[model samples]
Target chain A: MTAPSAPLVFLPGPTALHPRVALETRAALADGFLSESHRSPRFRACLVAMEEALRSLLEIPQDHRILIVGSATEAMERIIEGTVTRRSAHLLNGAFARRLRDVAVNLGREVVEATVPDGQGFPGSPDRFRDPGVDRLLDGAELLAMTQNETSTGVRIPPDLIHALADRAREHGALSVVDLVTGWPSEAVDPARMDCGFFSVQKGFGLPAGLGILVVSPAFVERARERQARGQVTGGYMGIPALAQVADRHETRATPNMLAIRLLAAVAEDYARQGREALDGAVRRRAAVFWNAVVDLPGLTPLVEAGPSRSRTILVVEVAGGSGPLRDRLARRGLLVGDGYGPGKGRHLRVANFPVQTDPMLERLLEGLRNEV
Target chain B: MTAPSAPLVFLPGPTALHPRVALETRAALADGFLSESHRSPRFRACLVAMEEALRSLLEIPQDHRILIVGSATEAMERIIEGTVTRRSAHLLNGAFARRLRDVAVNLGREVVEATVPDGQGFPGSPDRFRDPGVDRLLDGAELLAMTQNETSTGVRIPPDLIHALADRAREHGALSVVDLVTGWPSEAVDPARMDCGFFSVQKGFGLPAGLGILVVSPAFVERARERQARGQVTGGYMGIPALAQVADRHETRATPNMLAIRLLAAVAEDYARQGREALDGAVRRRAAVFWNAVVDLPGLTPLVEAGPSRSRTILVVEVAGGSGPLRDRLARRGLLVGDGYGPGKGRHLRVANFPVQTDPMLERLLEGLRNEV
Candidate 1:
């Protein structure tokens, strides 16, 4: 499945680098964004502009501070390091969610984990946590973390459930961190409601991979700042308070991926100009294009049968046979989508409904699945 | 003095994006390096090839393992985190060298630091650390770290002196870590001798900022691996052993800046083709062009007067009276170099001798100094 030649990438995370976004890299060079100093006023301006664009595109609350790190994986570590003092809880259903749990464990913190098996939604499925247990899970925990849209299994914890849990965690003195890696802008997020939410631009912004954005609510920042002010140990560049210290100046402590930051600013501006409703509708429409065709496609069936828990960004499907056949068929038509993640690796297919996967490619994918599967 | 429109950047770090290196980002998009999964074979192959090119260019020994990180600053944090078990010693004379010591301190390690005043070199300067005291610096240290070419001070610990110190550290059971951030292929390095050498791609490689490269000796890897195997706590993604585990398979634990990695590989390959002599000669030639003009250029004088301890890469000069007037004079001619780092910010000048500063730019800079200064 190493189709470096494929013009279209429908993989859940990377998706496709939309032509508009791809051209931004060229613009970065033309405008000398590459050679600009990280300490310069120009870089500061770029940071301020990027923050504004991200705020407009994602409707981030005014109280949250946005940080640029390496990847969502990095975001998970920094958040856990900065926010959690002792005990942290995780709701896991897929590979990425588990990665956060692993990050905490590696950091030598107490971890409490609740899991729903692959191919099942956390709330829509029969059972993972009882109502009372949900209360117990947040109790005495410093932080609670989960992925909003699990890219691996195409299962989404309902947004309302996320807000509910955030509220519950707050009541129990726990901060909630949401990893909305593969779904942003299209999957509306309120940083205030979630407490702390982070995502990678390559996933939904249709840009090259590298930089990660972590948005921390005022409560989250206050908690971390309090901890730092109390003389608790902190990390270096990626440390919570260390990053926040420079973020106030519209700068990063270390030299960042300037070109990527510039590209995100440009792409985020594009999304803002396209209007949030139009952007979200495009995502919903393309996802529905695949979902509606599931009945006609011989072997393909939606992974999350419950519409309430299904992900509109990363659409997971279970082929009647192994996913290999359908994936191979699609490869023949020069289309590439992600194979199953974690336990579902070889048995399922994950298709991206990112803004970059335009109609022509979607049609090609649908035609390939219909005729060949 | 950010000259984004100068068409040339002579700054110390993020020197200048060579035209050849800039084109590689475009190649990345065309080849789908951006869309490819980090865990895929293609990325593995890219890593393998990049390692090979880097080895050839830097003359890294076969026993060393190369790692791709976010920045040299990230490398400082990770290296200090992984390698030092209890105590570390630092030979610091500049801002960047102090950064490593600070990283160790943040990680809660016992730090023994030795320092010399600015505008003076370690070996060339008289009376910083006595000969007997020098022995004590590395005596009980778990690791000894220093910057080979202090980009901030334009001072260098000559390679032979570095080897002497590394050998002495080894005798006392300590590891050597070198931050040749702004000097690499241009200033030769031996990973076996240095133990650990890390640099940012934007520096000597003449590429966009984002990625850092760390080359570790076999001993460095073995020590970290043994610690991990013994059930000692390690980091998550950037844990020495965790990174090594995937480095074996030629992949990063997280999705890296693939485009930056590709550009480094391409630039390294280009240097290999140009041969090490030509590459190093180009750097020396540029530095000599500036060093030779010191007498003629009225306020600007080489900061490190001792040629043996002076950096051929980051040429630091103390501006008589102040650097403001001379910097403005050069600015009018559309040339931009770095301002002195740390305390020397407004009083000294730092010009880069990176490969991207071709003869024409060098001539323009020299002419500006002669006429305007």
Candidate 2:
């Protein structure tokens, strides 16, 4: 079936574009700015502005380097290829986290994984490692990987647990990398807590896909350099050293998604004007609205326990019946939410509560659900 | 200084976007299609349409697989990482070709390179290997890589020679890879001639940057699978096997530049309607106009020798009094061209002659050059 003339999309990611960002992108196209050389002063300014805006919006530390890549999956591969010389330890909670472990294995790195059930969130706070099994897996590993917000199951690792895990990895002389794909500004991330972290613009940032932002700590760069020096094969183009070298001059190693980069800068500038506290408060309010609306809906139950472990960005609900009919019903009303991911396919529906979802849109989605259910 | 309100960007790609393609992209954005899930029928139709359009426009053999990637540079890295088991050989003509060698070396592969001065085309016709040195380098190599058109120096390899080189590599049991970055539909590429070929949307296709199109033959896929089976590392997301697997269903490994992909399909469909002979003839006409206008211009000399060696898509000229001032002069007049690439730095200027450069723009550029020089 053909999509409606103008559908209100609320998919988990490749989420709705902020209207202002979309307008700016259209203007960019009209102005022929995409034709400019990546080295041109205008394009370079765009890149610099994006990097600066992200650093400010995310509170990235001075020691960390921000590199724009192709996708979050690409960032995952780069991090594993660059830092993991021998072994990588992964704490897998859902599809995305399991994909990280698979990437490491595909690259022929020795993998140690500690996996929980799909919908279960890791138990712990910032002060300690609650899972002894994961802690043991991190030992002797060159890289420790985790997903801050598991998109597939709507489970978010507590910020305190993330910080504690990075500390533990540091103690064991392993670099820590976190996939913040679905939990960046909305969920509140501190780049200083981890050696490297990545997020895609299509998710919480509310922009089109294509660009992946990778924040690298000095220690991570050093690890990659040491690995390269020791004759280990770090990748090209996405390699840490090459990316770092180009990023020093506010450039990318390859031609990037210039339109997305420009759009991100505009969105980041908006965030700057709105202030972090205000943005965070809006996200919190939206998450509450989403949870309250869906929690008691007939046939729908929250995927993750309602607590610190629930994701603020993506709200996943387990459906008693197959999600296909319900999703089709929503789509018929021009409302779109993500289908179940991986094994959750047809059983769960993922709704994104990004900053771009206006209150009216959220209300409409709720109205549609109420009518359908 | 700030750019003009509407500067006419002539910078060799990301080149100016075709007006129709840009409008199509804007319409797609307005439709909220970018937010659709990659697996959604709407988005899948887009991917399938793009692959089909490209195959039809470029006359790709039925056995070839067309994969969409992030950028041409990423395609280079993937081809090298997947195909080169231990030894790979490169024929270096310009910066981009040297980059292929660097990618191989950076990935810890043994690289053998045959070198020629920049702007110098390989000698001889399609029947024989003109350079014994290059022939020697290809021996015992698992993959032989070359560039169909080097963007750095405006050097285009004759199509017949490209096919002959692939044949030579096949005789040596090595797969061939060609970078048709700036020369594809405009240059009449035959996909059956090479094991694999790649091009970016921004260059020859006259679309926005970000999406790279890679065409691979069954032989290349077999080589990559064999290498993987032999325990050689074959990357993760951009790996040939993964890309091939995803392409079978007309999907990318990750969230791609959906907008660019859509734009490419539209442009390719336009090309399909226009037909190949017509497209090639237009390129030929544009090249003639560009050359005739600049051939007798004072202080400007063509970079490559005239005749079969000259590039039809990009024209490089050496400036006696430095290209910086001339380029700025053109920019102030709302015209832009590429600055010197690689070591050419301040001494040369590059102009793109893609299908998107309208007759009026071409005349305006010629007039601006004549007056300035």
Candidate 3:
């Protein structure tokens, strides 16, 4: 009468929910946590717990404030609106980075972009921050935006490069914001190094797709306050000043996704219990295994050039002919991988190496890939 | 090992999740709907089905469009940004109405408000829209905003009054928007009469708290286009044009709460099966029972004036002493009613009489109220 259960999903994100987190979310739902008032002390406790857990797991600095929002894209919009006054520069190499640039443009900000091919990393090395060309672009920009992990192409900007760019942006009197949507606890990056960074819970956290966790340094808050003082239209609900004021009291400017927030807190607590190094090591081990298998596969090649450029969390590979048949075969075999993003659709397969991916699931996926090839 | 389950929550909102909808949501979660890509046809079907179900249940006209957003507050922000070019007028009777007014002000619009005290309804009768005083306020306004059901005060504007005011706004070349956050389907108001009307899923829909359904008329869309043509900011992710374009394909502009959307579709489908008139009649019957119980209870008086002004969905009562001890007594007995909203915090209690309130639950709440008194 009823259809069979669907296979475990391994798509880029929202990735498979960790069973423990799912159980906690279910209990929360049944206990009426979702129905509690956002202004209630009960809900505030959830907020406080979530923030503390995330801070410990992400290693967020003491001065940084964590604001929960609707999505990572919203975080981008908020950061740009709250901080950018006159000009902003973007390092665009993939779809997500280009979206940040477009959001700035849509909000009427003056935007300067340094772009590279989709699958390629940002141009030049981290040392290029000293180059005059890079300095020229950053000169008058109020904010310099970059994607730490570009979900579209599975390319990661080296941590050294991100830090270098942030340092250069600071020299130019600009704040730097990074999007870590697909790369977070799995691949630890110091939140203290950037002015602001954000990620959605659906990616590395292996939760549902509603809540976006944004980390804002005190300097970023100061910039937002300056904009507010100038009576600029920072934003309405997504305004950083409003968000910070409410978050200070452990609340949101608007009603948030409580179930998702609770689930994230549970997941974050789990991560903290396992210890960050252990979790990151497990993720790295899984990534290594996945990368090795793809490299040995008959007709597949990594999307990003090998070395530090490839993302540890998202594995993208190009299919020699087309990816449709292989994807279909894998799907039939109960293994799911993401389709190519944007232009690469049908030509590449993107797989997630999130911490939640168990060894058995990975082995099954590899077997599926080998058989399909 | 675990603490006892939480009491049944009767908070104004996020209200209790209907058991049927909860079951559907849990099944959807297990089926991996939450993990599906926003661009996937699977997710699009959920969106399309939700819109169609809501349209059928709410009697939305053919020319009207429904856009799903993050919250009712977001719907307010989006409508204000998308429609109001320079000037807006608000009918402010309670906290929610004032919030709409504030949103316009925050977005930098010239807001002219016609205010009344918190416990009272809008000034004058429904026929007052025909009076010159209301016309004078609507004259130069680009958009006129009003709350059909002011959740904060438990005061609902009569359907006739809402339609009349909308007609007046149209005559004045302004679009009219209504906040039906706590009231919809429970009290059937024709959406064809207003340019826009919105509601959050947590209230009458008995789903989770993440999604807001916004119904937009063709006139509102045309006004948004005019604003866009004038180079005004129509919002980025919350923009009407972008939302409508994506909604045309049965998708949201950004990642949406898939679990909430699916649950809403299921609930709407159930409502449709039961018939709107029948559903509305059941709600009216429940409201009658609730009001009668409140009238009979000791040390209690209805907050809203008795005749035609009280909200059927949310019943507000002022207690003789403070409401704290009474609320505590109810909670101890496994009954939960909302604390008064805003200024009424310690002196009043707000109870929801939504369609999902079962007969047994109502009896328990009524019994609890009597015992507490």
Candidate 4:
């Protein structure tokens, strides 16, 4: 019945939003800053606050710059366009991994395809760079790209693996990029290890869509400038250097998504105040609650098993009779989980364990799975 | 001292926001649709509703398509990238007009420049084609582009000028594009006349900055596809055909600003109910209050002499001293107004008369100008 009109969202990408975000958003709306010119000192402060909050929360290094973009898709486009000139290698294990490959291809870059089957993980588990296929792809590549967490499948190749891949790319004399689209806040994507890493706020930050966060190393910035110098398109109005130039003034090249950006700063500042360890504990605690509830249902089991590859934030379960019926039954109880992504569409149900989803909400969701499903 | 903490925003852009838009934005944030999947039917409906509301409000013809972009700057990039292949003719007078030419040059397109002095608009009041320089710029150009309303200099080339320019472009076997960024809602940008027209919502729409509206004709769509066929870049992630394809499904290439989009739809629906004439009368009425109060101020006068060239929605006055002193003086009284734009930086003060700016707000601002300045 349309999920009881006001259901708790559990989608993978634009997951459950915190009421605090909504409250802060409303407060921002009421303030005069909502209508402030992006060039104003007040607007500049908002951008600085957002950047500083994110820096403190993520412990981002001084050398890495945070560039705000339109969306994660746009982030992907920007990273590939701004960084990769001739050859880029993609590690495709899921839909989003393939998406990077697609973005690179769309930009007419030479893509070195490295893929595993959709449901399968790299043979070396978390140490994917140890795999021969990945090694082959990195060879002779100008840049290597992979998703730190693949939302399409409930596969997360932890931060350590991203670090390892970056090291591998460096050994091969290539830069590295990471797509942490659904794996930030809950998981740290250490930017120091890679040339670039990016995500959107709607996934883990409990904010609305429309903001893309790109963390680029100084070398990466140089590479984008080099691309521009070489007569390659480094983003026209959205050119990497152009955005960075205005960003230094605490503004954007084009009018940015101010509402979403401000809300993100508030949320990030909240997380920083709470500290990352507490956030990690709470996230783990909530995932356990949902994982404990849904894993043993009749003919239903956790996808990716419990391993290094399993996602901590997004929990996916494969249903024997397709996800539609189970999701429909859950919908009847006002619980809305995500449908399977791509190949797993009807066969899987993806549930999120973001910080915004409180314990009691998870309990209610668990009860829905137990009694309703 | 800081504009009384809640000054009315009368900046040329990101203008005074309406409380209705704030309320509607808050409502949208509270709703679960904020976290809903962009692929969901509910999200599709939001897209459709926004499109329909705009179509009804702008009287958009059947052949024209509405594409939602990141910002008006992005809209300009998309139109130039999607439609223009080789050579483009730019009619420039003010900053934002020069911006399109900047965008074209940035995209590596061949630009033929035509211009009038900043304060002095085209020789003929409404019809710019009477100028020999404008006539020459149109010849042998693949596309003719000009700003319908120059936000920087308070000059508006009326709809009739745009229509006449479009006729000239067609006669020259070229397409015409118009930048109605600060002009829309207060001024109707008829999609039926121009091949492409665009604006951002933060202007006369009385909303926060983020969303951009692009209305493209069928012929314009065909031109974009043809550009893509010839292997020209038509916007990578924001490719016009790709955006149009998703738009048909009631979605965008990127995760859109659902909050802004929904609020815009609500506002557009509200305006549609009030009818265009009511909005026109209200805008003009509000302008009169501020204009009458400021026009005869000591050593102050209108920027554009008087007549068809002057902007009605954004009323700019030439302050004898740099606009800073007067703006700072008014700020002490909590009535914020726009400073001079670009080359006019210190010499002019721009005041907006959007529907959201109540008569009392303008009265307060005028009183500040009369008594303080």
Please report the candidate that would top DockQ against the real structure. 2
Q: Which of the CAPRI classes, incorrect, acceptable, medium or high, describes model 2? A: medium
Native-referenced Cα lDDT, model 2: 0.85
Cα lDDT tens digits for candidate 1, A119-138: 67776432333377888888
Native-to-model Cα distance after best TM-score fit, residue B137 in candidate 3, in Å: 1.0
Per-prediction DockQ, in order? Answer: 0.68, 0.75, 0.65, 0.64
Give the CA lDDT, 0 to 100, for residue B134 in model 1: 70
* lDDT tens digits by residue: candidate 4, B83-151: 887889988879888888888887788899878888666657435475676678877787888887788
What are the clashing pairs of model 4? A235-A239, B323-B346
What would the per-residue lDDT of candidate 4 be over residues A1-373, giving only the tens digit for each residue? 1234678777876777866777777677767777788888977888899999988988889878889888888888878778787789988889888888887887778899767776566656446467786678887898988887788887877677778888989888788888888777768667788888888888888888888999888888888888788877776588788877776677788779888888898999998897777787888888776677666667778888676777878788898878898898888777889999889999998988776667777888888888755
Worst 10 residues of 2 chain A by lDDT: A1-10
Residue lDDT tens for model 2, A16-107: 87876768976886666788888778899999898888888888887789987889999988998888878999989999998889899989
Off by over 4 Å in 4: A1-6, A125-132, B1-5, B125-132
CAPRI grade, predicted model 1: medium
Q: Model 3, range B97-135, lDDT digits (tens) per residue?
A: 888888888878898889888888876676877888888
Question: Tens digits of per-residue lDDT for model 2 on B140-215?
Answer: 8999998888899988888888888888888888899999998887776689988999988888888878988889
Kindly indicate the candidate among 1 and 3 with the higher DockQ.
Answer: 1
Evaluate model 3: give its TM-score: 0.97
